[model samples]
Target: MDPRLTLVVISSCIALCLGCTKELSVGELFYGSVIETKSSPSAKHCQILCTYELRCAIFTFSNFKCELKRDDSGAIRAVSSSIISGRSLFSCAAEKKEACFRDEYSQVAFKDKPYQTVRTTNEKECRSKCDNDPLCSFYTFYKSSAQCELKFWNLLPTAEVLYSSTGNLVSGYSSKLKLNINAKYNCLSIQSKGYLLENDYFDYTYSGAAFTVEHCQTLCNLNPFCRVYAYRTNGHCRLKLIKDSHTQGAKLDYVISGLRQTDCKPNFVGKKTTATT
Candidate 1:
């Protein structure tokens, strides 16, 4: 066999095996404070810096500034409203991963009223909030409203089959234990639904198919950034890459809407040193 083909075969087999071992950082961000202002672009950058530092247990980023810390030994306070904090995951470790599945082109809604309501900036943040909260399990996100409707269930949620294609409304599950692909990604979508306006309204669709809502969702789940999609009952599947935007709103009934499952997977460059060394 050709060397490249052999490599591809090995890769495929590894991905196909459900029991494949995966390395993950078990670290969690406790808290952080502004230690110094260093030129940086975003909070992700600061996180990468903390991952590289030997003692950097936590980090904060705000107003184009980066602050790194060794531990939360002092009063845990935010420098300002803009400060974003994160911690290294070396302390936490990844075990055998599970397959992650989300309905990209469909959502499960309950007739029961939302148990709690939490304010958030986007879909990913809302999912994280739900994952962290002990009481939350299922949630619906209104993209136009920037509102997250958190719902709790003693068991799995299986209810009404309401679907939307062009609307900004989306639903998702809490982040429990899903497999990490090991690639660095900045955005993630848990689920979405809806499709239409084919002549020429939104022209960014990469492909179309005679697909069902469930099929559309699987396509979206395969992509790291595809949170939105339009699906029709006629089997027309329209894949979209229009990422999370705080300003986008719900659309017409002819279209069904979908949203991504979670936010960006926290990236760390220092994880290797911290874990292996």
Candidate 2:
């Protein structure tokens, strides 16, 4: 989430519970290095925009100009303003939201092949894409190339940090801790019909009636007892109610086995059933 957008969302939620104003005061600012600048409508919007940015430690807005700065070394505060200055509450709120921790290294990238690749407009969007993918542990984004590489491994291949002279590449890792904003169901990754598993027995069989793999996965997600499932092309969806049932390297060509990656395991005894034509 964008920090300014995040603040806006939080403020809205807080307003619903308790009526509050848009005023947010962090503290008096000093000299800082300007990271980026954007046109802002109001002082509050500028504050929110600054708070929304990860690197923006402090910001000031005047005459529709918002200057976001990085104040890690405390040098950006030579001049302070009370009319349009605010501090960032992102770190504090990030803990509550379980936001992904980021570490950016300029001109650095992983040498090994990435498990996945996606295109994004900015580094922030690229990082967010990696955060959403369960398999992605780290990622690299090149501004000039416009390529986002999502890697499965946490560590870089070479001990030496990759460097770029032009300073177009930025790389980082995802914290993996994510907030389950979706209250209904925690769905797993969906694979094609070619993917199948062995040793996993389905406890119950349901007539899918021309249901797709997506539909069967949804059904499994909704049912508490379902842990794994197998969906056939003929609309036979089998829901497994046991953990560790999926044996590695067990492949059934006709059945598509879908595994649920949840912390909760089924305890009740399940009866085996066959699909009826």
Q: In candidate 1, what are the lDDT values of residues 120-148, reduced to their tens digit?
A: 89878878777787556557777777888
TM-score for predicted model 2 compared with the true structure: 0.31
lDDT (0 to 1) per candidate: 0.46, 0.53
Name the regions of candidate 2 deviating beyond 4 angstroms: 1-100, 154-160, 177-244, 247-277
For model 2, residues 132-243, the per-residue Cα lDDT tens digits are: 8866656889999789998753211111235467789887766553322112233336454556565554445443422345445545653445666778755566776665
Could you tell me the lDDT of residue 174 within candidate 1? 60
The TM-score of candidate 1 is: 0.28
Top candidate by TM-score:
2
